[model samples]
Target chain A: MRAQSEAHAPSRMVSETDELCQKIRRRKPSIYSELLRENILEVLKCSFPRFGTALAPGKLDEIASHFLSRHGAKRPQFHHIATEIVEFAHRGHELSKPLICLLEYEWILLSTEIDSARIQAPQLSGNTNWDTSKISLNPTAEIVATPFDITLVDIPVELDGTEQNYVYAVYRTVKHTVVTRSLSYVDYCLIDLIRREGEVAFNALVSAPPVQLTTDAIRQWVIEQSQNGLVICGTEC
Target chain B: MKENALGIGLRSELLEALCIQPAREDIDFLEIAPENWMGIGGRKRDQLDILADKYPLIAHGLSLSIADTVPLNVGFIRDVCSFLNDYGISIYSDHLSMCRDSSGYLYDLLPVPRRKENIEYLTGRICQVQDIVGRQLVLENISYYHRYEDQMPEAEFLAAIAEQSGCGLLLDINNVYVNSRNHLEDAVAMVRCLPSNAIVYYHVAGHLELEDGSLLDTHGTKVGEEVVRLGHEVWGWHGPRPLLLERDNQVPSLDELIREVGDVQKSIAAGDRYACSI
Candidate 1:
């Protein structure tokens, strides 16, 4: 009898819960606006995870307030919403450049993540032949420049950022993982050139860079890059 | 990937470990959020290609916002179908919630009302998505924080949608467990009431316990003992199916995850054995 009653306990809970839902339903009205508010809040929380803890006082509030106030009567995608929020944070809040730098870095990761997923593998143009000089940009890659060295946000505030910034590459790997790494100006030039020039020769790509390098050095760099999937060789392309 | 036990989501943090380590005997298959992998190139895409070569891929989309009251994104659906076909992935699922409507992208799954009007709307949308994808999508129950007064019970709503849309269910057992405690619903009864045939897979994940003792489905912590127990019950009730362990946050070391998979495998076996005896 005890065992049987214990088994029946959950069923009893079910009915009680159903009744509770019914009661709540009767008391409350629709959840359209409530859910809209909830979604806005949720988006703010997810996209800007550190607004409250990491950023300066009032920065988060200003962004949220501006977004909610303007977000009237219509819904917008979070990315567009995030951009406006960042802009609001910039204009409305008296934030330090470093702070803006930090926020931009954080937001870029999101935009990059969402943007890359939407890219379709470029129809290879049916080029099965590999040419040493011919190369193209990785459709799944992003190139960004930021000053804050958000790469090093933990260091003291004064040491965090500078007017001088560097370009960084965010690329997807075979594992479908997005990897972010800083790039030297020379390295950026080489890749950006490859992006601009569809398929080119090793000698031609090397010649375009202003910096003088031995043929051996250029060959070595391409060889190194090809290994990393940054620079493709004739057959692989 | 293990061929017959519980699986895990392929998160970015675990990519290197998955590539370096020997095939985890515990992972039956890997669940990829197509939103995370599709169209990405370079090492991540290269590595995913390798992983795909090694194991079967199942897509669980974070976007698609299926319940939104807006025109269907026919182009996006076509792209999704192309991605699935290119990867040779058969099973694609998304949360039975909305992320975007005409207003904008919510970026998170939000619950739809359990009203007849909303149900009819979702039925049409689900069918539209299935038609575009060229396969029926497996819709998962979401762990939502609040609910409005609805026309029917949650299970009935889910069943109705599954029946009307002709879609399958990707039952997230932890959602049932979390929602049960949060909303005062009965998780066990919720599982029992769901149409068993519609259930194509299961998801169990860890959740956070808030200061006030509320359970938040953060997927950042360890899977609680109760959820594992509930997994057994779900398996017994629904019979053998693909059960995925989603750990997006606070992911453990690969070795630890392998052990977790091993543990769930035992529960799956127990559920199967009990079903056989019955």
Candidate 2:
């Protein structure tokens, strides 16, 4: 039982030893702390460049240190750490809504670029039969609504926290290039519906609440989005 | 890849440069941290496919955390093996230190206690990893800063693990030099202590010296002259192995790195000639 416990929960076996080493590490300041701290900071800086710039002096470092002290051991991958940094900022930092939104925007861009999930759109030899086809958004596509125009902010000061009422779609194209597009509320609602339902029929989409569009408008919009590689036309209705 | 071959750690920064010159003669092979490539897609995946076709790739994992007392991360090891199999790479190396504890991954290699008693524990883990990888798991000696109580020399610990577990060793010459200087040990003697049969490859990289004289394994700059001299001694002792140039940060242009690779090759040849004459 002891051996089994040691094998399964190795930390339990050496909790005292680990504690001792942690104390020694703190006193001696090994390369581990510096290297780990640097990795976290580098990821945060790269993921949200504007956020790094906006934070006051040493705030970014504090955040990185906090993250390292808290979640450093938890995340081994760079993207995973980046995600935790964004999450920590939102939950703990009391960051401005604009700043949080900006971080989310930047994260979406970084996340979709490397997202492994692929969506295979059904091959349409003829034109996509809009009336009978099921429509779905690309798996890599993400939609976010922000209170402020975080995209328009050029500098830290430009983000005045005023409401800009922005809705955006960030998705990776077939070529794997991440593209961000500002979306109208109606388009946002349609994408949200497709995202929530997984697959939506053409009539169902047109008849959906918050999407009171004519058949022609809906068809045109779907075609436009398809051209943009944001929407995929699935099986025959 | 041939013995005495030169390779470079393939960083994403070098992808554009590497893609342009797939047939470059200076780089005999490419080493990658499989952790970076696994479960990733997009243009990066496409780039990896192109490069894999061009040069033979070896897997050097980052998050194995082999020395952790907890159960082995079998899932991650399998994924790494899968990546290696996909690329037709059989040589896989990771640090002989813990990266993850019970809480989670530290994202940095922490020192494994070098006491004699650890040999059995470490041996078991190493053997388990080798079994999972379906190949000899080559363990690199990490540059640790501090010493622990009742610690044996790192060389002894490493040699024991390699011999007992039948694992291979990646002799990071820079790390050896750093640890030697920091801990007041003879670097060459440490290399001599390691079992020759277990030493499979060599890692030559740059390091930074702190104000207090302790060396940091930064891998930021060019391989230092002292480390190159040590490499000469290492190759002379172990004969020429597949030596990889690791530059994790402040990476220069490909041309500059290629030139550096050429320099190391020349040094290794000179060392071999010296050994033959002796």
Instruction: Report the error of model 2 at residue B258, Å.
Output: 1.8
Please identify model 1 stretches exceeding 4 Å from their true place.
Answer: A1-237, B1-4, B268-278
lDDT string for model 1 (B53-164, tens) is 7768899987787776556566767878989999999999998886654444545676766766566667777877887788988999999876655446788889988988
Native interface contacts kept by each candidate, as a fraction:
0.08, 0.40
Runs in model 2 lying further than 4 Å from the true structure: A1-17, A20-30, A90-96, A119-128, A154-165, A201-204, A207-209, A234-237, B272-278
Candidate with best TM-score: 2
Query: Second chain TM-score per prediction?
Result: 0.93, 0.95
Q: Model 1, range A107-217, lDDT digits (tens) per residue?
A: 776665545443333222344332444555555567778664557635234444345776887765434445577888778878888777765676676688565777777
Q: Can you list each candidate's DockQ?
A: 0.10, 0.40
What are the iRMS values of all candidates? 14.7, 4.7
For model 2, state the Cα shift of residue B172 in Å: 0.6
